[model samples]
Target: MRRLLNDLKIMLLANFWLIPVIALLVGALFYFVAPPPPMHAKMATGAATGGYHAFAERLRDELAKEGFTLELVESRGSLDNLGKLLAGDVGLALVQSGQELTLSERQRGDLFGLGVMYREPVWLFVRTPVTFQRLSDLADLRLAIGSDGSGTQAVIGALLAANRIEEGAYPENWQRIGGSRAANALIAGELDAAFFLGPAENALIQRLAAEPELRLESLNRTRAYLARLPYLSAMEVGEGMLNMPMDTPAKDIVTLGPVATLVANEDFHSSLTPLILEAARKVLENGSLLDPPDSYPAAPPRSLQTLDEAEYYYNKGLPILQRYLPFRIASLADRYIILAIPLLVLLFPLFKAIGPLYQWRIRARIYRWYKHLREIDLQLYKGEWPDDLDAEIERLEQLESEMGRIEVPLSYSNELYQLHVHLRYMIERLRTAQKRRQA
Candidate 1:
């Protein structure tokens, strides 16, 4: 055991040069690897009570679990959210699917889609006892299309345009007020009907659904609208889908509307794509009335180009490391993995050289003694002998004893023994010369 310990000590001393070399390589790895993704980001959402804002709040909570802070920026609606992304005010935003049609070609180039979060159905609620067979039938009555610069207004304008009802030809009875104000007006008998855009599970939508005097109307021309407006999807709302107790719709309803899509700008980090999307997926795991379970955070009906990372996430779930590790740690591991191949290539040759280098170092300790032996043999060959021949012989014997205490691994024992033989031969030659001088 003691010999084993001594051998280990010698081996460690021999390879001390590797310490600095390994440190240098590790430093290079850190210098070249990209920094970890940002731990915080800004998101643009709609009014405080709106569905976009509500979804953003849920997303913020989910990301917080992974130690990521999500700052939510309040805006008017989808158009406002889109504007924020274009102005570079926020890294990400929730936008209605068709709102991109309002963007110019240049503006469109600045944005990219992550995925759709959920469906935003177009709900048209009118005062009861005033039934309309078609949208044109209620043209003469008081109407609140939607607020200015809101997604509701955008969708309403498209619907009117498809029906050939140009804005210039709009009736004087049509109003631009929307949201709680519109719902209030329709309840107070001030307006005949109002258009709202949001998920059926939205608080505002649920409130309006439970209203006794207001009636939720279906878009009978859904097929025609979908054909003309490709971005709109046909949604089937079964009886009592919104509220099982109140039986909100009273019967089956078919509506055509746009989806709420998660959009990102060029400034948003691509590496954060999977993290955000996965959080969103978790948020919508239990689908709403119109959306099936695990049906959302899907990859279509986007106006701008889809992010490559987002596409990868949709095709295959979260990256392997991200699934098991915390997001920050996982992201770090991911970056290291990208550079691992080159790092390994560099270390391979370095590690391979250790064996040969160590061998040279151990052999050097035994070879240095040969210098003293060579000097003695040269003096005798020149016929020049020392006066204290016996004392010289005694010193050589002491050297041989000292050499026995030096140790090398078993594999190099042959070299050590050969060293012993050479030392003995030199001592014998010195003794012979001393005896010849005495005779």
Candidate 2:
């Protein structure tokens, strides 16, 4: 151990600059290859009672169980959620599907989805029976199209515009009250029709579905809607799906809806993706409204593209390392696992070459004294040995003393011993020559 350390000391002293340079290189590697995982993250959710908000709370609680804190910031709706994510107010948010496709290249580059958490069916409730087969029939009636910035308003607005209803043929017909309020207004004879974009579990949605006077519109133009709005899909609610006991709806109701996707800033912490996704699985997998069991958390959401992690997760599922280890450690391992390959390539050669280089350095020191010894031996053989015999003896004695104090690693001790033997032999030859000259 001591000998090995001595060799390392000598090698490093001879090439001391490498220490800091390598340290700097390692630091840069860690900086680029192994960023620390975020301890906490914030998500921009919707109104307190909205589906997005509820999903966020469940996610927060799930993450908290694993010692991670997820803060939920309430916003108006999907539009507001998108705004917060872009402005960097939060790391993630629940956005209505399809809105992300409207962003510019720069905006798209800044955002990505984890996956579609669940489908949010766009529901149209009418007090009267489906007298009209189209959305145009409800134009003259008093309607609530949800809050101004809500996904319900955005989708309904598009449908209204396509049907030429937004051309101001009926200016006083619509109101901007949100889901719970709209449900109440419809029951009180204030609203003839209303739209809500959420799961059936919402109290307002549940009550509206159970209302005897009100009827749910199937939006018979669902195919045409999907043709124009690729983000939405045709959805069907089964007869007993809402309330099995009440057999709410009494029949299947076809509708149009955009699924709700869990989106995040592109720079959001990579480690949290799978963790939140797994948590989403627990909450959204039971399905909602129109979805069947295990129907949600779909990869490559219909509207926006997803992070590559989501692609990997969907295709391959969670990493094996994450399955065996804690999330933080596993994430760190995954981050640097690629880095570890290159680092190993770098360090293996350096470590393999070190011992030889160190030995060469040790040999160089011994070679210096050997060079002087060679010159002295040649001089002693060529001339009358007694002329500078005393001086030569003194020179040999000094060489021996100097060599005694010299150090090398124990592995090279054999070479050092050979050097001592040569010195002693030279001294003896010099004395023999002196005696012969005197005789």
Candidate 3:
């Protein structure tokens, strides 16, 4: 053990460069092999009082329970949300369904849909009772353009343009209120008409519905609009949907539009994919927001955000675990599997090389005694008592004692024991030769 330690010390001192090299290699391997730091997901929420913000907060709370940190960055609306997502300012965003957005290849590369949350009905409120046949009728009237870069503005802008309602022909009265403020402005008679894109049960939408003076204008041209734009679907706001202050019920109100979607970067980590899906399942599939049971896609729509594994399973009507178990388990198993490969690669060569080298070292030690014995036998044949005869016997005894201490595997133990026995025989022969000389 002392000799082995001395050899190791000498080698280390001579090859100091090896110590740092080994450390750097180990550090680099550890960096690569270790799991990445937990993601701090940034989401672009809408104005504080908007459904986008409310839904984002709900997602944040749900994700928090599962050990994830979600940062909600409030923006104007879905248009701003998409802009943030495309600019890499956020990882996730809430986008309205029928927004007219043209993404460049670079922008498109950064974004993808997780799934639709819920449909946002386009509620157009007009103060005066007029035969509102089409969206073109509001072209010359005072209209709320919604907050700049909002989903409401995006959808209304597209609808007006498609209907050939040129901006030059429209009234000069345009307001930029968003969320609950937009509802407040319309109720206060500050605006002629307001467009709100939110859930039927939204506080602002309900407030407006309860107002006796205000009327919910049915874009009776809903089906025509839907036929023109495939993304938009006509939804009905049922009778008594909103309770009035006077106990009056709002009758069947026909509305138009599409749902809000949860979107993420295309390169989002796959580990986070399940968490997003789980949250969506809790909110949309479990009927947290909607009233009627099972009103969603009987079969998944072939649209944006429907490409996810979880969504695919949801459409197929299977449990989350059944569809996702293999993927989840594979992610976990990869860590251990990665470690095993390198260890096996290193050990195979070490075992192969070290076994033969160790055998050679042991046999060489035993052969040294044979060489000394041969020289002693030559001296005995000369009929001379060499001055070093006693010293040679002592040396042979010491070598035999050293061999007795050697340990090897049980299979190699026999070879070690044989080497010790041969050394003992050589020592006895030398002693015998010495005794004969003395006699």
lDDT score, candidate 2, position 40? 93
Report the lDDT tens digits of candidate 1 across residue range 88-144: 999999999889888998898899999999999999888888787788987988999
Residues 1-439, candidate 3: write the lDDT tens digits. 7666754554445445545755765566567775743556898988887888887887888777756789999988888888888778888888887552455556654566666677888888877554466876775566686777888877777678778876566667666666677777777887778888887667777777788777776668776777777777787765655564523234677777767877777545645655666665665555533335444322223444434554554556434452555433544555546775775675577557655665565456456556766776677679765687689789878877776665433445566677677767767877887788789
Candidate 1 Cα outliers beyond 4 Å, as residue runs: 243-247, 371-407, 410-413, 424-439
Query: What lDDT tens digits, residue by residue, belong to model 2 across residues 213-263?
Result: 887777887888888888888888888677776676667888888878888
Error of 1 at 217 (Å): 1.6
Candidate achieving higher lDDT, 2 or 3? 2
- Candidate lDDT scores, in order, read 0.89, 0.80, 0.68
Which is the better candidate, 1 or 2, if ranked by lDDT?
Answer: 1
My TM-score estimates for the predictions, one after another, are 0.86, 0.86, 0.74
Badly placed stretches (over 4 Å) of model 3 are 1-29, 37-39, 98-100, 174-178, 244-250, 266-270, 288-391, 407-413, 428-439
**Cand. 3 Cα-lDDT:** 0.68
What residue pairs are clashing in model 2?
A: none
Q: lDDT of model 2 at residue 168?
A: 54
